[model samples]
Structures are given as structure tokens and as C-alpha cells.
Target: MTRTNLSDIISCLSGYDPDAMSVTQARQVINDFVPPLATFEKLAIRSALDRVLAQDIVSGINVPANDNSAMDGYALRGDDLPASGERTLPVVATIHAGQHYAHNVSAGTCVRIMTGAVMPDGCDTVIPQELTHAATDGAVTIPAGAVKTGDNRRRAGEDLRTGQTALRRGKILRPADIGMLASLGVAEVAVQRRLRVAFFSTGDELRSVGEVLTPGCVYDSNRYTLYGMLKRLGCEMLDMGVINDDPAALEAAFRRAAEDADAVITSGGVSVGAADYTKQIMQQLGDMSFWKIGMRPGRPMAFGRIASGDKEAYLFGLPGNPVAVMISFYFIVRDALLHMMGAEQAPLPRLQVVSRSAIRKRPGRTEYQRGILSADDDGIWRVRLTGEQGSGILRSMSDANCIVVLNDDQGNVASGDLVQVVLFDGLV
Candidate 1:
């Protein structure tokens, strides 16, 4: 790609109103950029769970290793049954889960079997133990109509045929995937390594966690917040702690971040503030596209990267406000992380819910309002905003289970109006 001037970036990002980029614009910018190529690491299946698969997995063996019984029952040849319901069949033998029978089930004969025991040769039906009455005299009188041929029989290779592709590449493994692999006797899997993420916070008034909070200083949140969010995305994180507003310190942090991480995430000190050193560092050190997005609580967001030799690393400067960081991540960086891990175009969870109260908004900018959703008396889910929309109110975010999203083209939404909701679980 050629060099993109600041004016071109701004004009291209003006799809949202208020001369600011929206979440859609932010996503388009990255989706249009060159994504970092991912690598794979062979880890144990336990570790590979929830990670995207680097290659497709084919079945190594039949799903069922052998033809076995589907129930704790008696295996017999039903074709030899008498016309009447009474059929006195002498017990030819007994078959447990492991031991093999000495002989095949003969005509007018049956073998006592347990669930999961391989069916003896010549036995085509299984009569459940509860349906048959047996005497200790080596005689089991099974009703003629108790079970038919092929009843309670599990056929081998029914679920998955050998050499078939069970799971495709780029698909994230889940619990069921684990079970499927286990059925094929696969004890390990090859998965992409966790994305390496470097994160820190920059502000003159910020302090580290567990430290005493001063009158004007607050405990740094961006590091912990981004750490947790990245953890959920299966990323390996290197926390740089808190970087001050000093230009030298910020530059040094960038040098380390460029060397160690595939992506660097920072919060605060990106806006047009006197104490902000990020802008100065970006201008001097590397090419970065910084802009204000047209969304509540997250207007001051930046996405860019620096080139070192033939290699490059991403940089994201999020607004310092706690809520802004969270909202911006959901709309901007989550999909990028997913793409880096070889996931298919990851999309946010968009849900539809009714409005419980009137929500006012201008018709030019998409807004995300932290909301609590509940089903009303009519069994309809309704969503409404939390008390305040300020970026400093962490409690509002904690109290909300989802964000009620309103598009830029939509205006005020009255009660009973339908709105789309994006759940928080998807963000993490």
C-alpha cells in the first residue's frame, strides 16, 4: 500500500457524521489494512479448545470402533422365534464388555449382553433385559415380539466415516469438537498460537493498581481491561504497566512494544492535550492513523502501526475513559484479533429487543448506551439505558449486560420500538 496522507484518512473516515469515524469506519480501516500473518503451534487438545484450528481435521478412524450393543440387553437371532409370544431360548453364553464369546449365537439361542459390548457374530437383534423374564435353569423366555431385527444395535462408522473431514480449518474449537476428536482417538490437536499482545496505559495522572490513589490520580484501568479482553480472545499479553506522559518514556515503550508484540494497545494521551506524548511519538517514530470517532464515550480513538525492516506491529490508542475503552474494543479491535488468529470474518452479536423507554439521539451518529435488559409482563425483552452515559462511570458498565445500539440513520426511539443489542459476552 502507498502512503496515506492525514487528509485522505480523515476524508475516507467521514462515512459517519460529525466529521468523525464511526465503528463501521474503524472496522473498514483495519479490514482494508494488511492483517498480520498467523503461525500455528502444536498444543495438547486441552489447550487447543476455543482456539482456531490452523488446519482441517480428518477422521482417523470410524466413530464407533466396533459394532456394539446400544443397551444392557440380550442379543439373539429374531428370525428363529416361534409364531406365539412364548419362546424358550436356552442361554448359549454370556458376553460382557471386553471378553469375546467362544461361539456364535446359534439358532433358537441368545447371549446375555451388556451395553457397549460388541455384538456377537450371528446375533442380529437385542432384547432389553427388562423385557425378558429368565429362570436360573439356563432358560430365558423372551416374548417373540419383544424386539425385532437390528433393534438396539449400534453400527460402526455411522456417525463419521473414516477419511472424512470432521472439522474445517479456521473454525474455533468448542466442547463438542473436543468430543468429536476424542471419538476418533485423537489426544492432541494443532492450533494457532495465542496472538501476542502488548498493552499499557499512558497518562500523567495515572497510578498502578494496589497503589494508594492520590487526590488527582486514579488507578490505571486500561491495562487490566485490555488484558482481560485480550485474554478472552486467547492472546498472550505482555503488560508494560503504566507509561508516563514523558516523550522519552513513551518512545522507549514503543521500541520495546515493536520488538516484543504483534499488536500494541495503549490508552490515554492521544487527544489534543498538552500532556499527550503519543501524538508526538507517533509522528516521529512511525506512520499512524489517529482520528476522533463519531460515537459516544469513544470519540478519541486511534489505530496505526510502525514498520521495522520488513516487519510491522499494530498500535491502538484508546481514549482514557473506562467506558470508552470497552466500547471501542467491541466495535474496533475484537474482529482484528479474531482475524489475526485465523478466524473467519468474525462479527459482533447483534440482537433485537424492544425499547422500554424513549431514547433521544441526533440522526447522524451511532451511539451505544449501556443498558439492562429484562422481559416484561408480556414476556417480551425490553432494553433501557443505565443512569448516565459518562465514560467515567464504571458502575454503569458493570450494571449492564448489553449495549443498546442505535444506528446513525435512526432518530428517537419510543417505548415498544425495536432496537438491536450487542451482548457483552461476545466482546470479551
Candidate 2:
């Protein structure tokens, strides 16, 4: 519906079960309604912990930069070794790491070197000190032994070379990648700006968690839950706090949340209910779509945009139930947020796990049954159900280490069956 027609709030956001919209269909709608935000900024290297690389990082110098010893050894020209007996090679000069070489190996000569020391020039092999006999002077005798032409020597640029792509755009830098960049002597990196997100909860009956339990009022948790997950992704967030279920208050909160955020996310008020003002107010001022995606515990989720001049800030309305929020974040918003950040599109990891019990489910909705993964003695991962799959029971979500992903077309899963398990460790 157009913004003009949306001015009149819909008393009922469709009765369509979240399963009515397929994941593909929902993603398409999200793409059509919410476009990516404009790019901005020169972020500091240390500040870009999880941000996507906006530009390709190239090495200015080779990793290792020069040939160095992989172990403590004697640098010698293999061909210069004597045919028999102890070949006395004068220890010409020592070459240690981080120091320039003043002497190169001459014929019948070698040097005592430590691991990481520059391989002396004109030396083709390294005889680890343990393999050789000691001498009185700064010299060692080499006994006849097997020696490869260039063993134990790490060549310059062997790991990476100057002008080679060290890191690509859209790659989320891991700890190893960070060290690799540092090895290239890169103290700074160009990365996409951290997405600024805003979050809030809406319900007149909800009270702050620390406050005393009042009659008919439950503790507010959506704001903190969303905040925690987003924080783990390195998001810059603004907590909009809680706006009571009143329409005017909801409208003011929505306006403020969209004011400085790339996205504004809420936990409730988009379902087929009369009092869900978050949906009503969103319809009035922005072009937002409320979809009941075909997914369990997360069917009431919505995705769209806030009209901001010629642009629209993205919006994701999560379900009120705790488990539904987790599911929506994993199956929906996470990818879109990654795309928005310019990170390369990597498919979410999926695993084949053995089910410990039968799961009752329907064909239309994809169910994410919370479960604990057990590793057998053979080291294979198997999944077992966590008691009662109620979406509102936050404890089950907390104790769960993985989710058994039941396909949309499949229903009940019997015990001893192989199923897909999406791990909570970020790997799967």
C-alpha cells in the first residue's frame, strides 16, 4: 500500500500466519522496500573490530620481507661442504633477526643463526645447530648428512607479496586477518562505518525488570535482548527505551529512533491485534511492510523503511516472544545488516545432526527447535531437544547451544533422525 493510503491505520495486520510468507518471498520484499544506506567515513584501524573492509587492503612490502631461518641453525653453502670427514667452515659472521647483514657466506664458510634470523647471502641450506659438532673457535664442522638445497629457509614474500591483495573488500576481519594486516605493517585499515541502530519496546503493561513485580505487568526484556545481540555484532546503538502502548507516544518514539539510525528495530505491535500501535504509527509516517514470515516463533516479524528525505532508513519489527526474536535475528536481519555493511555474502553455516527425539511440527513453517548438541566419542555432533519448545520461556533459549532447523516442507521428525543443526557459536 502507498504511504497516502497507509495514513489510516489498519486495525488488523493480516491474519496470515508467519508461515504464509516464504523466506525467499520475505527477503525479496525486504530488498524492494528497504534499500541500503549511503556509505560514510574513515574509521580507525583499532576501531574497526568487526566492520567490513570498504576497500581492498594490499601489501606494501612482502610478509617476512626477507628470507629468514625457521629454526636455530648453521647457514652454509651446501655445495661448499667437504666431500668427506669434518669440513671446517669458519663462522664468517652472525646474522640475527631485525639486523642488516655485514658479511655474506663465502665458500667453505657458515654462520651461527637463530630462528627468524636473516638467512646469510650465498647460503643455500641450514643445518640446525643440533645436527652439527661444536668447534673451539667461531666455527663448526659439518658431518655428512642429508640436506635439501633450501631447507629451513623462509623466502621473502612467501606468505604474501607486495601489490598482492592481502584482504578483500567486504571481508569481516578475523583475529588472524588483523595480525596478517599488522604483518604487512598496516597500522590503519579502511572499513565501512559501524551501522547505527535504534531499539525500543512498546507495551503499557510492561515494567522494567529491576522494578518490583506489579499486578498484571511483566518485565520489559525486548530492548535489552535486542541490545545484547546487536552489541555482539559490534553495532553502534541508541536505546530508545520503552514507549507505552499509547499511539502518540509510540509515534514520537518511532520518529526519534529513525532520526539518527540506519535502522530502527522494535519487538512488538505488528501482529493482528487491535492495540498494536507500533504497526499503526509506522504505517502513518513511513513505507513499512509487516509480514508473517513462514517461520515458527517468528511469524509476526516485519521489515521495511522509514521515509527520510529521498532515502528510507531500514526497519525490522521483531516478535515479542524471546525465542522468536532470536530466530528473526538469525534468519532475517543478520544477513541484511551484513549486506548493508558491505560484507561479502557468505552463506550461513548449516550442519547435519542426529535428532534424539521426535519433534511435532507443521509443513508450512520452518521450525527452529532449541536443542543441545552432544559430541559422540567418534566426535560427531548430535542434537537433543531442550524441554518444552515454548517461545516465551527465555530459559530454554538461554540453555540451548543449537537449533534444529526443520525445513518448511517437512513436519514431524522422529527420533534417531539426521537433521540440520544451526549452532549458536556463530560458526554454524
Candidate 3:
């Protein structure tokens, strides 16, 4: 299929405004610009965690392969069960897991079956061992109302059937998915190759760890945080370290990153008043756009693709502020990379929670405030700000459990008003 151009996509969008790019508009455009790499590799199921599946996995056989007992009980024909009184029957045989009874169960006879043991033919019910009385005389008595027909029997292929799709393509494998694949007797699966992401921090005032601090320089923390985030996303990282703000140095770094990586991410030099040569160098190399997105902490962003010689890579130029860099990567670049990796996972749902204190906000732009989500006095889930919310305040993000999201049309929130929040950690 021919790839769609970014300009064509933007022109088709109704109500598009370039100067005041809405959060939704910016995300949609970025998603359209990037494409997933068409490559896959086979790996053992145990080693495929968090990797996107490249092909649909179909089951070759039924999961359980037989009707089995879910508990240690007596398996008997349902017709032999007394309607309202006690019933006693001879214990014909005992069936253990991985073993089956050779003879069919007849009326007035039952089999002592262990958990996961296959039920004998003609047996439709299982009365738990704890609910029955067994005697030394090879007889068992089931009390009235012990169990209904098919109460404890698990049907064959209940969990998965032969020729059925066990899992679809583009799913990120989790623990349960690995177990499921094992149950289906899958030894290996084809998954997308890990994405190659090259990142760097730019600024003349940035210093590396262990380097002597200059009078006006600060230690670079963005690279460390970016490493963690990219590692969590399962990308092959290429840290290019800190690039000086000199025009020639920045240009060389951009060219090398584009030639070697699928995507290039740089912190600083995108915002106004920092450096004019950064934007000029980016445009001279590729179709990059510097936009003032209508969002808090991450408003200044440069996006598009850059090229060197015959190779090209997508670029994400984010702000230099520590908190702003983290937020931009999570809210903006994360989704784009997931798409580039061909993951079809849905966006995380924003949970509705009450605000414990009033939040000062303006309308027109979206605000993402660092929040501490906890249960209130009534044990109801609520969110409160983590004190200061400045873009440069990294401590606020460190102390937050979630990001309280106020939409573009939302105004200042009252103390008791319900708000939307997205958690940093999840069960998946």
C-alpha cells in the first residue's frame, strides 16, 4: 500500500488550525506520519513478553482434550441421583489426574475422581468428596441437594477449541498470554523486531554526570529518564549523550542519528528564545514542523521526519525542562512509538475521581498536573495536586502517582468536582 503523505492528511482534517494545534489534532497527525516496520522474528513464548505478535496464533488441539472433574468428587450418572433423599452407590473405580477409568459408569455406580481427572462415559455429575460420605464397604452416600447435573464437570475445549484463533496479531504478550500459549502447546511465536530508537539531549548549559559543574550549567537528567522510559517500551536504545548547541555539532548529530535509527529524539533547542539555528538545521535536513501545541508543560514541540543521505528517521524535539520532557514522551511520543511498533493496544482509560482541592486552570488548553491519587475520608478515590506544578519542577512528577487531566474545554475545578486521571502504573 502506498503511504499517505502528512500534508494530505492535515489538509483533509476539518477545523484544522496550525497555530493553535489541539492535543487531539497533534496526536492524530503524528500517528498518521509514522508507520510500523515490516519485520518479524520467531522467539520462544517465554521470551516474547511485551513484544507485539506478528501473526495470529491458532490452536491445533483442544486445551483440556477431555471432560474433566474440577474437584475431587464422585462422578456418576445424573439419573441415579435421588430427587429429595439420600442416595448410595457402589464405588466402581478411582480416577486420578493423568489417568482415566477404563469402564463406563452405569446407574447405581460411581467413580471416585480426583481434580482434573477425566470423567467416565455416561457420567454427567460430580458430588464433592467433602459433601459425600464414603464407607469402607466400597460405597458412597451423596446427601440430598449435593450437586446438580454438570455442576463440577469441565467440558472439553472449554478454554480453547481446535482451529480457533488463540490470540490475534499485534497483541503485546503478557504473563497470561504466555501461559495461554503454553497451554496451546505453542513453543515459539513470530513477533515484531524490537524498534531501534536513538536519543540525545542538546544544550550548551547541560553537563554529564561526573563532569565538573560550570557556573551556569546543570546536570542532564532527561537522558537518564528517557533511557528508563524507552527500556520499559522494549526498544533497542542508542544513547548519543549530550550534543553541544553549536550549529555544526547539532547538524552532525542529527545526520548520524537519522542514518542509524528508526526514530530520533532530542531534548531542548525546539522552543523559542533558546536557539534559532536548531529549527533551521532541522528544516534544511527534513520535513520538520515546529508547533506550539495547546497543552501545558509540553506546548513547544518539533515533529516530522529527517533524512541523511539515503536513510531517514522520525524526529521528536521536546522541551528541555525535566518534568516537561517526561510528560511529552508519555503523552505524545509514547503513542507514536507504539504505533511504529505495530501494537494495536487501546489507549488507557482515564478514571473518574473527585478532586480533594481546588485546581487553578484556564480554558483553551489542556493541562496535565502531577497528582497524588488516594482514597479520601469516605474511602472514595480522589486526586490532589503534588504541591508545585511548574514545568521545571521534577520533584512534583516524582511524587505523583497519576496525571490529573483537564480537557481543552475544561475550566478551573472546584474542590469536590470530579476529574479525570491516568495512572502511571497499571496491572497489565
Candidate 4:
């Protein structure tokens, strides 16, 4: 498939400015540039969970396939029901589940049917066993107001009719979806292949875990967090460990990641610091945009498409701060990756809840403050900021259950004021 050029995508957006981009503008650019993968594979239903459907699943048979009893009851003709008093009928035969009575049930006689048993011909009503009394004489008595026509009977195709769509394309299959497919007698389904995502962190001061901690060096946590987020999204990840700030190493990492995966995500080296070689290397290999977004914790970001030889992949250069990396991924990269995988994704809901404390804020930029959401005594949901909202404080993110989103035009917030928050549970 022909790929859309990044330059053309950016040019089409009104008021596009990379240096002073807003969070909404950056998101729109990524959404417009990314395209869904067309490649798909057929897999057994057991292996298709969480995978996007490639085609609609159409049912060839009715769900029930026949009119059957919904409960253990006496199947009788509705016309024989008496107007005021109880009526007794002879029990001609008994039918268990999966059994079919071929002969018609005559008036004044009924069949003792178990749940799921096919109703006898000419019987349209079923009086539940508890509503009827059975005698030693092989007869049952039903009260006048017990049941009407079509009671306790499941009709054919009530759940799904022939040639009806059981599931639509682009749906992410869940456990219930798998059960539905099984009910239609489908053993295999066509699903889009898992998205391949390559991610890494860059900084000379970052070290891997289990290594000796030298002076001015810290262990990398962004990669671990990125892995967890990507795993939850069902993407196959290639974790390229920490890369030094050298220009040669940065260029090689970008090229290799682009060649190997459908998308590349890197934390660090997108800011305007002198040692930030990632921006230069990315610009040289592809049509990249470096932005100073009007957002807190994650203001510096790089987004574009890069190519290596005949392969090309989308690249997202996030900030080095631990908390910023997470906020960027959740707000910007998550939905774009889902779209590329051909999954139908609904926007995460932002709920407005009362604030538990006053918050200092400035206009002209968005801020994502890590928050703890809880219920008050009256069962009203409220939010409070995690202490020490620093970008490098990864613990704040761990303690937070939601993100308090302050819009670009919003200012300081007073206690008891309503604030918009997106729950972490919903994003994952």
C-alpha cells in the first residue's frame, strides 16, 4: 500500500505550528498520518482473543435452530386452557433436553418437557412444572391464569437469524465474542496480525538494572513502563535497551527500529539540550517534526515517519522524564497505535469530579497531574493530586489512579471545584 507523506499531512492541517503546537494539534497530526495495516491471518478461535477481526462473521444457522422449551414444564395447546377453573390433561409422554417429540400433542393431553427440549407439534404454551400439579394417574393440572400462548418457549432465530452479522470487522475479540463464535459453529476466524512495536530509552546517564550504579547514573524505568502499556494493548514489543547519546549510536538505533517494527517509541533526547542527538538523527533519516508542545511534563516531543532501506515505520520521540513518558504514551501514542492495528477504539471518557484541594495553574498550556480518585462519605467521587508532582517523580504515577487534565485555556483551580479526569483503568 502507498503511504501518506508526513509533510502533506501536516500541510493540510489549519494553523499548523510545530514549535508551538497544542496537545490536540499534535494528536490530530498523528491520527491523520497513520493508516491501518491491511495484512491479516486466519487463526483458531482460541488464539484470536484481543485480536482485531478482519471480516464480518455472518451466521448461517439460527441460534436456537428450533422452537424449544425454556424450562421444565407441561407443553400444552393454549386453546384448551379453561377460562376460570383449573384444567387437567393426561401426560402422554416425557421429553428431555435435546429430545424431539415428532407426534402432535392432542387437545386435553400434554407432554412433560425438560428445559431445551423441542416442543411437540401443536403445542404453543408451556406451564412451568412448579405451576402445575402432577397426580399418580399420569395427569397434570394447570391453573387458569398460569400461562398464555408462547410462554416459556424459545423461538427459532430469536438471538440470531440466518445471514445476520454476528460480529463486525475491526472488533477486538473478547472472551464473550469467542463464545458467540463458537455458538455459530465457527472454529477459525480471520484477524489482523499483531502490531509490532519497537521501543527504547536514550541517555548517557541511564543504566540497566542489575548493573553497578556509577556516579550521576540512574537505572532506566521508562522501558519497563512502556513494556507494560504495550503488552496491555496486545502489541508485540521489541525492547531495545538503553542507547548512549553518541550520534552514531542514535542513528543506528533509529534505522534498526524502523526496519524491524511497525512503530518506534523512544524516551529522551527530544529536548533542545546540546547532548540531544536523537532529534538530529531522526531528522536525517526521515521527515520528522520536533515540537515544543503547550503541555506540562511532556512539552518536548518528536513525531514523524522514518525509513530504513525498503521498510518504514512511525516514530514517536517522547521526553526523558519518567512521568512525562507515560502521559505522552497514554494521551498521544495509544490511540494512534490502535488505529494502525485496525482496531475500533472509542475515546477514553474524561469524567468531571470535585477537587479535594486547591491547585495552582497557568493558562496557555495543558497539564496532566497525577491524582488519587476516591469516593467521599456521601458517595461523591473526588480527586486529589499526588504529593510532589514532579516530572521525574515516577512514584506519583504509581500512586495515581487517574490523570487530572487541565486544558490549555484553563487557569488555577480552587478547592471543591470540578475537574476533568481520565481514569488509568479505562486507558489500559
TM-scores, all models, native as reference: 0.85, 0.88, 0.97, 0.94
Choose 2 or 3, whichever is better by TM-score: 3
Predictions in order: lDDT: 0.81, 0.77, 0.90, 0.92
Best by lDDT: 4
Question: How far off is residue 137 in model 1, in Å?
Answer: 7.7
Backbone clash pairs for candidate 3 read: none
| Residue runs of model 3 more than 4 Å from their true location after superposition | 1-3, 135-137, 274-276
lDDT of 4 by residue, 223-291 (tens): 999999999999999999999999999889999999999999999999888898888899999988889
Q: Which residue pairs collide, candidate 2?
A: 18-292, 18-293, 18-294, 19-294
Q: How would you encode candidate 3's per-residue C-alpha lDDT over 88-116 as one tens digit per residue?
A: 89998888999978887888899888999
| TM-score of candidate 1 on Cα atoms, chains taken together | 0.85
On lDDT, the stronger of 2 and 4 is 4
Off by over 4 Å in 4: 134-137
Candidate closer to the true structure by lDDT (higher is better), 3 or 4:
4
Superposed by TM-score, candidate 3 places the C-alpha of residue 321 at a distance from the truth, in angstroms, of 1.0
Name the regions of candidate 1 deviating beyond 4 angstroms. Answer: 1-18, 34-36, 77-91, 100-103, 106-108, 131-149, 308-311, 375-379
Q: How high is the lDDT of residue 260 in model 1?
A: 85
lDDT of 2 by residue, 1-428 (tens): 34432212322334433447777666655544444445756665666667778889988998888898887878888796656676767887777778767666788788888888888778878888887787545888788754566888899999999899989988888888887877887778878788888888777778877878789988887777788888877778999887888988887777777777888888878787778877878878676667777888788876667764454467899888877887888778877777776678876788898887888888987888889999999887778888988888888888889888898999788988889988889732
